[model samples]
Target: MKQPNILFIMTDQLRWDCLGYAGHPDVKTPYLDTLASRGVVFERAYSACPSCIAARAALHTGMEQAHHGRVGYEDNIPWKYAHTLAGELSAAGYYTQCVGKMHVHPLRNYLGFHNVELHDGYLHSARYSDIPYQESQFVADDYFYWLKQELGTAADVTETGLDCNSYLSRPWIREERFHPTNWVTDRSIDFLRRRDPGRPFFLMASYLRPHPPFDAPSHYFDMYRSMTLRPPFVGDWESTEELKRYGRIFDSRTGPADPELIRQAQIGYYACITHLDHQIGRLIMALIEHKLYDNTVILFTSDHGEELCDHHMFRKSRPYEGSCHIPLFLCAGKEALETFCPSSSCRGLIELRDIMPTLLEIAGADIPDSVDGTSFLPLVYNPQGTPRTWLHGEHSYAEHSNHWIVTQTDKYIWYTQTGKEQYFRLDEDPHELCDEIHNPVYQERICLLRNHLIDCLKNRPEGFVEKGRLSAGKSYPPTLSNA
Candidate 1:
């Protein structure tokens, strides 16, 4: 009974419905499609705090946002978790390594992996003028440092004049082989070629694409540029005035005003996804060539999702389905698949925190006492098993900050700044085109979900709940006082 190797694959800002296996009509992700077909896909997976730092905090620590203390998208906060996914597996005699996107403070914090080949993908905080030379992305990020050496210091990912967070896009200015997505795969394949063969290994191959600067190779961009694609879904609650207010700004949370810009963004985003998918296929082939395919367990997911102009929103940190819902699946060898993943898909609700305990259980390692998440390994074999009754999610995003509760079939959102509420019956409106907040038919269910959120926030330091009710306009911080 030898322990199986683990391949944790993560993509940044990837929407839940962007893959062919997810029934997306426009995107081409044949490798990911095949993986989902053979594995168990969690049809209702979500990121509780749908931002990079908060989501990764949950993923690595197996703790919810409140427990882990990151509720928003702030950067430069130190990561101080005692027990991490990689740390636990390393303690259990597995050699652990992460190849890309640690995204932690001081630019090189390894959390618990034995080694990390870092590339956090064009962070403004890391490249600030006041930062020391040694800690800057130019010197600290492995991939960026290599790029400078190969093409001189003047060469940069921003050479195409696109902001990292902007919806504007173009093809990569350099060779396709030098792209960050390809670099992650290249380094991961190299690791497989020279890993410690006697012991099981835990490898996290994280990619930063389909996020922004939407610069895939030209060939991939051309694949979708000419095809007719679906337009963004507009909700009944969205205001035309709000769209016009922020639409003209680059890197706006509300998307662009021009329909042509939105269409081009979609073309660039889908191209980046297909480019990422092919890179994943290369890793899969490397596994087979090394005869490690049968002994590996591969889990694929994203930190959060891009809004892609859904409901007129462009970026993440929203409570809507496009920003919070994420794709999650597990593919494994024959024996593990037969014993654990007996079904092709499960309807159970899952969050980023659950990844730690599930992978630790698969590795025969100890689930640390600090973890607040439950392993969903049981649900793979028994799809009816409940991982959780509901999930409470929130993010601190200035005036648009929100709190939400979601079950498998419905959702409730409360805007902290304005006390605005929105409800949606997801089983019927999967795209969330209609807001049922004022509808009489769902008032009872909405009240129940609201109470769930109140209970979740009652003990928090921010005083979100007061005298058995939710209070609006409370001051919010990205990290809790305890953190």
Candidate 2:
């Protein structure tokens, strides 16, 4: 039997619940919904570190944040992993290529793919004044180079006056084909037409939309701008004073207090998602047209998730479900499904790390000893099987830095800087509207999860654990010594 081709479609900062198949009332994702129906959806998927750099590290290395040495959202840290997903596949006789964001240091690090058409979106670090000209985003990104060629050198993604990390939004000012989302699909389809026909290929179509600048085409933006969407979930633990403190700042992490601003942000976000979904539909069509659909295995997921004003938070790096929880689903032809995932859905816990081993297993490649992630193919065959009892997640975000333990049905969070803690019974409160940390009835479960985190952090360099208890107020850096 011929080895199956792999299409790994990744989106940035997309929330798990924003898809129509995931029961999102406002967002219309017909293509993604159709994709989910044809495969297994891992309902409990999450990004352990809940930040771009750390989460992508787990995805590429098949290792947890600790093993990968990136625990937070730091940029320019050299990716020095020995074994990577693309590397293993490439070694297994597959031609690997990545078309979009890799988020690695040096801006052009291939991370083991045979070739990369790099575009990491608007990275602030890459645009720094002192950075070398060759290392800058404009100099290294293929999409930007193409954009400038098509519309002169002065043309940039920042023309709409929106900050990349801000909640502010507007429709794309250029032609629809010029959008980054469209460019990724355009390049992917082009790849399909010119790939090595004799060998199976591994193509990672990584997109950078729905992350921010929230600039989808006008039709997509208009799709949800007039609808009555769901309001952001406000937890009982949130302080109104805190919300007001950072409300006026355009790029505030806590988001704005104005309901209209939040509503506009949601409209723009949903628009970007729908636009991305349509681009995915184009890729799917291209696969069918090229007669490669039946011989390919497709996996769709996001690195982490957007908070989108949930609990008054607008960005990621939080332990909240809005930040850590992500969408994960895999689909394939009839034969591939029978051979790999023979189920409709999986209820087992999953993280970004699991992506590497799972794809390597499906491709008939040997998973490296350096990988700490479980394949999760077993869980797809047996949906009720538990690959892991729980997951330990953390991020180093200054005062809001936190460590968390999450299972399929609940989560325990510990704020390292302030010694504050929060516990949520996810099965009962899916939106996390209530905090049960101090509740006497659930103290035993909380204690158990806390002990698990302690075990995970016991040997850490930051001294997060001391004498069987969690140590707070210790300064933590984003990258470990290995990085």
- Cα lDDT of model 2 by residue, 249-367, tens digit: 98998878898999999999999999999999999999999999998999999999999999999989999988999999998976555655544888789998999999998888999
Candidate 2: deviation at residue 85, Å? Answer: 0.7
Query: Model 1, range 292-406, lDDT digits (tens) per residue?
Result: 9888889999999999999989989999899999999998976444476533898899999999999999888989999999998888778778888899999999999999999
- Residue pairs with backbone atoms closer than 3 Å in model 1 (clashes): none
What range of 10 consecutive residues in model 2 has the weakest lDDT sum? 334-343
Compute the lDDT of residue 441 as modeled in candidate 2.
Answer: 99
Candidate-wise lDDT, in order: 0.91, 0.92
Q: Estimate each model's TM-score.
A: 0.99, 0.98
* Candidate 2 segments whose C-alpha is farther than 4 A from its true place: 339-343
Model 2, CA-based lDDT? 0.92
